[model samples]
Target: MQSKVTTTKEKYPDKPITFIVPFGAGGAMDLVARILEKSAVKHLGQPLVIINKPGSAGTLGWNELVTSAPDGYTIGISASELFLHPLYGTSRYNYPTALEPLAQISSTPVIMVVKADQPWQNATDLIAYAKEHPGELKFGHSGVGSIPHVVGETFSKSANITLSQVPFRSAAEAVTALLGEHIQIVFINPGTVKEYVKSGMLKTLAVADANHLVDPVFANALTFKEQGLELFYGNQFGVVAPKEMPADIRARLITGLDAMINDPDFKKDIEAMGLQYEYLDTKQMQTQWIFENKKLTNAVQESGVVELIKSQKQ
Candidate 1:
């Protein structure tokens, strides 16, 4: 039985692997998953078939991943949400318990943006306006308990201001609402708004990160700390699998993901999309997730988002 199990693990994936993307097609995560699929042929000697399972602010797909057979055949892409959703009691599986960290593919700084036509010029300008108007300024995010939503909350708390919160199904939808002037502001990754900023449709106020964006259009945007606010946060994208996946198979999958992420062409593709090519191996990924979880826990309490969400539900 032991030898049989060893042989089965050695054979590993005799067929195409199912790569589940916990978001809609054409979204950033989906695009990243497709890029990995392209690299899989070179690194894993097997094709990766992508399936979109977007819903419930990404919990649907994550639940799917958590429930899938603990074989190397099933894997999925995850973002900050993997550690975040469970905090708000949305997901049945938490990061440390239900999923095994693979390798992080990329990271991007979150930026505060508004329609270029709005009067606010920078983070200070927006905060001042929001202070006087209180809850009048509507702020949109991907969803409650999502990265953007938390960032927006943290920023509001740090700045001692108030803004109305609006939740959308996805970042793309929030961006669309901002474009249509349905919302006055949004906190999102710089890559998602790069084109809009260049086209003069949206203006970035501050980046909630330590470093400024490398892209020329966003290079001038200052960090929140630089603007006198003590807030820093961003999103990290990575792969994960069911926690009980066999060890040998898990090792094989990690090896493939490491090779695919480190490929020069893959880095180029990631950068071209305005995402930073930040790679973290399995152990490093787990450490980073834990670090983020600690930070987010504090933010959740300080921002009072839990109470706010509960009140809204009522």
Candidate 2:
């Protein structure tokens, strides 16, 4: 049996692997997939063919991914949406259970930002104005089941403010709307708005992280906790396969992914795109998944994000 297993592993992945990206092309997720694809050829001895199946706040693609055969030929990228979609009835499977986590590639801390012309200078000013005006202020997010949406809602709840929540197909879209003055604020990844923030087109208010970002552009930014809200959220990107994938196959994929992420060129590419490189092995990724799952469960429930999603549909 052991020899057979070894032979099977050695001969596995004779064909190209389909990498399902649940978000649109030109987005952060797509970029990550492309970067991994470059490294896969070296480590896995097989090409990773990226397929974009973006829609329905990422559920459309993730649904297809979770239902794919567990033969190791089809794998997908996992983000906060993997765990979040289930909470709001947008997904068919619970994350970290329905899928096997291979490795964590990167983490992008969620940040609050406003148009440069907005009246609020910092989180304090924004929260104070929000308290005064209630739902009069509007904030845009990627989608109902995205990290930005959940973090935005949680921030609202923690600050006891009723800002009007706006949903866009992608974080880029939300940021665009913010620039057009269609919304007053946005909860997004700092890297996405780094250029705008530097050019004085957008202003970052607070980051939903324990420590301020080390990026010199945002090093001085304060955390939501420092602004008197206990909100801390981030966007974690990783690789996953169907839960029932054979242990041998899973091990092979993990080995490939671990090697791919550790590549110096891969790290450089991810950092160049403004994403923080924080690689976690399978075991560490699983532990982090559990912690994030519990925390997200509470954030979703306490922040009334489900109710918010339901109301949006209605």
Q: What is the C-alpha RMSD of each candidate to the true structure, in Å?
A: 2.1, 2.7
- lDDT digits (tens) for residues 35-121 of candidate 2: 999878799989999998877778877888889999899999988777777787756677658888889999989999998888888
CA lDDT scores, all candidates in order: 0.84, 0.85
- Looking at candidate 1, what is the lDDT of residue 79? 90
Q: Whose lDDT is greatest here? A: 2
lDDT of 1: 0.84
Clashes of each: 0, 0
Which lDDT tens digits does candidate 1 get at residues 1-314? 99997888898877889999887776678778888988898899899999988777788888999999988898999898777677777677775578888999988878899999999889999888888888888899877777888788878878888888898877788889989988999998776777889899999999988888887789899899899987778889999898888778988889988999999999988887767789999999989988988887787777787676656645
Clashing pairs in 2: none
What's the C-alpha lDDT at position 67 in model 1? 92
